[model samples]
Target: MISKWFDERLELQKFKDKFLNKAFPVHPTFLLGEVALFSFVTLVLSGIFLGLLYEPSTGKISLFGAMVPAAYASVVKIDLLPLGVIVRRIHHWSAMIMIASVIAHLARVYFTSAYRKPREINWLIGLGLLGITLGAAFTGYLLPYSQFSVTATSIAYYISKSVPWVGDWIARLLFAGEFPAHATVPRFFFLHVMVIPAVLVSLVGLHMLVLIKQKHTEPGANRKRKEARGGQRLIGIPVWPEQSYISVSLFFFLLFVVVLMATYIPLNPIETFGPPSPVTPVMRPDWYFLPIYGFLKLIPGDLSISIAGAKIGPEAIGGVFFPGILAFILVAIPFLDRASEAHNYIENPLHRPFMTSAGIAVAAFLFMTTVSGYIDVLHIAPASMAIYVVVVSAAAWVISYLLLRRYGRAVKKGEHVES
Candidate 1:
């Protein structure tokens, strides 16, 4: 019965014709999704092993009760366990690679005009996956309960508190109280272990389904025919032994790298921070989230006023609203870019200027914010960094607009010449 089921699903001839036919060319960029998948696999494997040894209870359990590793010590022991450290190393490294690959894949999709028409839904799914990946990282960071984790959670708490009407409520929902308690660990553990993974898996499956249905978009003139014909057919290779070979090779290479980093650098435990304390000045979140934290600090404390007897702070407007708006804008890019022309980066600037500029602006903003946070931690003036970020962001926007104008003129000139 299993054999019949497998045979019914497998299209051996189609797989052979698609992959074995030397005519079909596979772009190196296609491997990005595979890398992400491999990372997810690594996450699952390491997570399962860690889960077995981990004690999720926040209630005061005796440190002396179990002869085996417990709580914080369990993680440390996992790192020391023959292949345990390697597993974590692979997991951590895979996460970094996964995030990076996802970004790279998005860039490839944008530059190649793959997010057009029928593929827009896939792009949105990709965006959702990106958010989930970041959330997974955030939740995973809290598991070790180290000093960095404590400080990071404090910053996260503050961010949650900035959320207007539901800020405090959201904070309570997340951490379960005023500060780090038994509830905090359990809540984060549940999210990291069960909730977020389930969402990620579902989204990933949707992303794959969309990919299989829509087919991968190609670059240059090769893609023009499909666009001209309304994209009625897919043009790509099969995902079997052919692409699988390359995918598995890349995954193992990355796994080796992850093991190397885990063994060498290891995950740092913030021993100095002691426990969650609001008075602590050295508090900072993981590097990935430093941008938001930096934005929170950059807002002027005096930039608050009473509108209709209700008070508002700059932190609320700049940190929460601005970021949320930007996220919405990013997710809505498929609708924003309405041009149907198929041109690569060099040929079409106006159509994609906003996307390119937005990417640059975000990168610059994050860099500035990260630097600003570092300076703040060192007792230096973070305001200077913030000012620089504002100046640079403004300048980038202006330059992008100018480029768009030039592109528009060029397109018009070409059209006139053809006529």
Candidate 2:
């Protein structure tokens, strides 16, 4: 009766025809986006549970007969609650997995040339999602108000303040004055629990709508052959059974993995770190921020320039300028490699020499920089790390370009080339 009532009111048949019966690509790589979505769902559910028990403040509270920040004390209380540790661990791991999956999904889209033409808007949206995800993670990192978190997050505080003209303003606005201030925890908590999640949810909805509109980009020229023979209809499983089955299975699998990891592996024990202190510990940002940390370490302390009476320092260069340039390049890729017509077929990376080579170089650069982030522990010199990064990235670019060009020539000549 309820179904019939809704069907009559909402035109359920039309909705099913539009979405439920639509074609969905049956590829393993396509699951990356779903994994990210599932992870986000997990985050939201876990976050709500945590938030109900959390105290988002830096105010002092009596904890175990000692004074501690309310935020830190609340975290400790949550840890004592039944299944709270597991829930927190799941939340932490889900964030990590979500970020990783988004990155991998973007990489798959890039290497397969799925960002071509009409899908450019989705590409931009995906990048926006990535930024929002990072922002979420960064804000959440400070909510515990622990020594480690405070110290690590303070690096970000300084980095924000490293901007030339309005650096101080930005830092004051974001961090609520110097790091670990009374208002800092509340500000971060609001962003992490409310603002960022709201934006993330909206963007995710738009992303799915755009995705459904554009349809999935299929791999290789097989779809082209099918299109030529029949009509331009997509060849894939219907969303009703096959795709839904896979999606359901994948979500459960993700949940199982997250639960298993949460049970076994502990993440960021704030109790051990203690509350925010004047004695800052030697700490580092999470792995996602390692590249920026590495870049900051690579630059010399003395590197600075005065521009229009404003002093631009190494922190600004490495933290702000480097990332800004990379983001610009990524955003410009679709525009720079504009297609004459809408492209629904994915191109092999080896066939696109320049794009593939640039990807290789950038990957090399990121990997080296990530390694460089641990130079203090690794006992490596900054100059040596810089030289190594440059040499390896350049060599990777040149070699990959040359090899791909050779392969292209062989394919054009119709020669049998071994992989």
Which pairs clash (backbone N, Cα, C closer than 3 Å) in model 1? Answer: 147-270
In order, the Cα lDDT scores of the candidates are 0.70, 0.91
The alpha-carbon lDDT assigned to residue 118 of candidate 1 equals 67
- Model 2 misplaced regions, further than 4 Å: 415-419
Top candidate when judged by lDDT against the true structure: 2
Q: Which ten residues in a row have the lowest lDDT in candidate 1?
A: 341-350
Summing lDDT over every window of 10 consecutive residues in candidate 2, give the lowest-scoring window.
410-419
lDDT of 2 by residue, 1-419 (tens): 99899999999989888789888866668889999999999999999999999999788999999899888999999999999999999999999999999999989999888999999999999999999999999999988889988887888899899999999999999998887577888889999999999999999999999988888887676676686888777878999988899899999999999999999999899988898778976677778888888999999989999999788899999999989998998899899999999998888898999999999899899889899899999999999999999999999999999999999998977754443
Best by TM-score: 2
